[model samples]
Target: MDMKRSLLRAGLVLAVALGAGHLMQKLADSRTHTAELATPQPKKIEKVSAGPQAAPAPSPAAPQVALAALTAETPKLPPLTLLPRLPVLAPPAAAKPAPEASVAPDCTPRLSLTATPRAMITLALNAPCAPGQRVVLRHAGLVVAERLDAKGQLSLDLPALDDAGQVSVLFSDASITTASAALPDTPLPRRFAVQWMADDSFQLRAVEAGQHYGDPDNVSTEAPVSARGGYLISLGDPTLDLPMLAQIYTWPADAKTTADPVIEAAVTEVTCGRDLLGETVQSRDGKATVTELTVAMPGCDALGDILVLNNLAGNVTLAAQN
Candidate 1:
């Protein structure tokens, strides 16, 4: 036939170029197994063109896959709005009590003595007294007396007091100068009473009975009831004119007319018999006269020569003054 048809067209071109080189080695062995299975598989992105979409650049694997999904996902946070408050106080009160003071009382008493009577009671010391001081007689609450040397001088003993009362004597040491008196209750008379007679040529007479006369309203019968003739009489009752009597006289020292009349002048009632001499004259009718005087007398002492005649009846007559 033409050569046998030219050898079958060269085996049909070599069978079509061996099938196109086996399909290009099977598409390069499936692209080397898809790059070894995409080398551990994490690349899957598919966002084609959603208009305006270009933010894809951070990939070191996309920062390790967004730090492992931000360390495995747990954070959405926001909600707590401001908070804090606490404080309040009040409580306290209670306290009180105090008061009391007042004092005064010292009755005072102490006094007892034996012999101290020269009479001296002058106490004056209104404070500040020391020296065995003890004196009390409040109103007879009796403690009586003390105080010897420290001289606030107190030497008492006038007690026996009867009437005029009023006494307060207190001084128990701190010398408050205390002492008072107003005593006087009848009992201070030892006798003294006479009346009348001045002279009949004075003699002597003094006889008081039941003596005990002190304040006969302050006595002073003007003294002088006769002592020596020149007369001074005031016997305002010295106990009833010294025991009543009369006239008497005797003068005969060998009288040769010792100047005449020796005793003459008589009346009745005669009881005058106690030795009398010249210058005797007692005539109120009771008769007596011996005054013919030869005058020779000097200091005569015959228990006579006394002429104190307080006449005018205040009776005081101690006659005999020759």
Candidate 2:
């Protein structure tokens, strides 16, 4: 019994062992099939990873394209060579200067005089006067002498004429005669001599010793000599007539003389201011008529010797002496 039990135990043990071995073999076979199927799927997944990995690495190259796009975003600038240039022109020339003009000449007249001590009077005749007039000397409203020269000048020698009183001298044409008288007066000779005052003026007095006589018969011893002719006779033949002498007496030794009497007579006296008279009376040199009478009497003021007479228009200007 013990032996049989031992054998039985042994067999049992062998059967269990064999059954375990067979079960192990079946598990191994199932594991091998699952491994094979899993292997093929793993290989497919590997192929998908490899193909997608190639696409991802190619996307990294897109950053280089992005960098090129960033460079294109900036604005571009143009070159400076397209600017335009300005043109230059020449300047204009300067203007020329104007020329100067001319002026007219002045024909003003002048007079001068001098006196001496010996009472022998020396008279000087000056400009703008006709060369054919006579100079008559008077004292105390009495005519002392007459003088005429070839150049319308007069010179007289007076010794007995008193200088303490005033003397007057008048110039007039010698060829004149009184209209009341039919026959003309006799032509008187030239040259005369008489006494003079201390102030160089003439007074009614006798002729002096050194003086030459012009009219000896007509002379008075108490009064001054009445000489018919003197130096003024040499001027020319007179053409004026003596109607009535308008005499003006002066004060005692006033020391004033005037040539305005001549100018005033020619401008305002009688018919001298009239156009008919100026045309009728002939000028000395056949020049313009005596439309303007100018006088220059030295040592005389208040009235100048300038007389501008327009007989045609009857206009006159008697300027005051300066």
Candidate 3:
């Protein structure tokens, strides 16, 4: 029983010793905590001012430090070099204005007039710039329209109305050329022309002292040149669009010759039922007289008949015979 009691006492003592050691450890931890609390730690203290704070001064080496940092981080580059300036050239002299196009020597028309036999004037025209151009020929009071040849040339004989012959050519562009010629002094036969617009409506007939009314010896275009006392010459081309028709009658200028010139109208289909209008130009005693006339035609029933108009041309009598 004593041994049991001793063993029990030993267990109780071990328990008390363990409890005391636990209490001492807890006391030591408490003291350490309290000591740490009692000691003062270093703390940053900030001043709270009521006014605006001044900006801090910049560091002396800040720029150099930043420059060094930038130089280290950036890659090395070649040194810059400026290219040589190019010479400025004066703008090329204003290109000499191209010489104005020269005018052709033959551009202007050339006109010439020459006296010819039988009191006629020869008209010559050279218009290199106006090939095949229609032009109006004006002489005294007479006017005629004709076209130039392919080579811009024209040559024609025109009866001289005046001793001092002056002719003018008018182009469609309103440009005109003029020329004059002196006619010969030789005496010309008494002549006259009957002009009309109709192609074949009018006929000029001259009855000489030895000729009958319908005889072949009467002066007509178809009569033989020598058989008839007077001669008839037809002028103008009937093929033109507006053909100008003229029938010229010439008689001897001698005082002994007596002649009766008449204008006859044929009653063809073209003039059967229409009136004909015409003009007469007579060159007598170195003077020209122009007269307008209108002849009444017979109806269609008289298609084959011929009407003689007496007053159209007066009787030709020399001054010495009169």
Best-fitting candidate, measured by lDDT? 3
User: Any runs in candidate 2 off by more than 4 Å, and if so which?
Assistant: 1-113, 140-150, 164-167, 172-322
lDDT for each candidate structure: 0.31, 0.32, 0.74
lDDT of 1: 0.31
Q: Which stretches of candidate 1 lie over 4 Å from their true place?
A: 1-94, 101-133, 136-143, 146-160, 173-322
Off by over 4 Å in 3: 1-105, 198-200, 227-229, 311-322
Error of 1 at 192 (Å): 21
Ranking by lDDT: 3, 2, 1
True-structure RMSD, every candidate: 28.0, 25.0, 17.8
Count clashing residue pairs in model 3.
Answer: 0
How close is every model to the real structure, measured as TM-score?
0.15, 0.21, 0.59
lDDT per residue for candidate 3 within 124-226, as digits (tens), equals: 9999889988777776555566778898989888877666688999987999999998664756567777787735457787877776667867777877243
lDDT string, candidate 1, 1-322, tens digits: 7776777777777777788788888889999999888888658867586578679888565334334445666887898876655444444444444444554433333233322222112233322243444444322211223333453344333321212223455554343333344223233211111211222122322222222222122112232221211111221122322222222111212223121111221111221323223222331111222222122222323323323332312232332333
Residue 167 in model 2: lDDT? 41
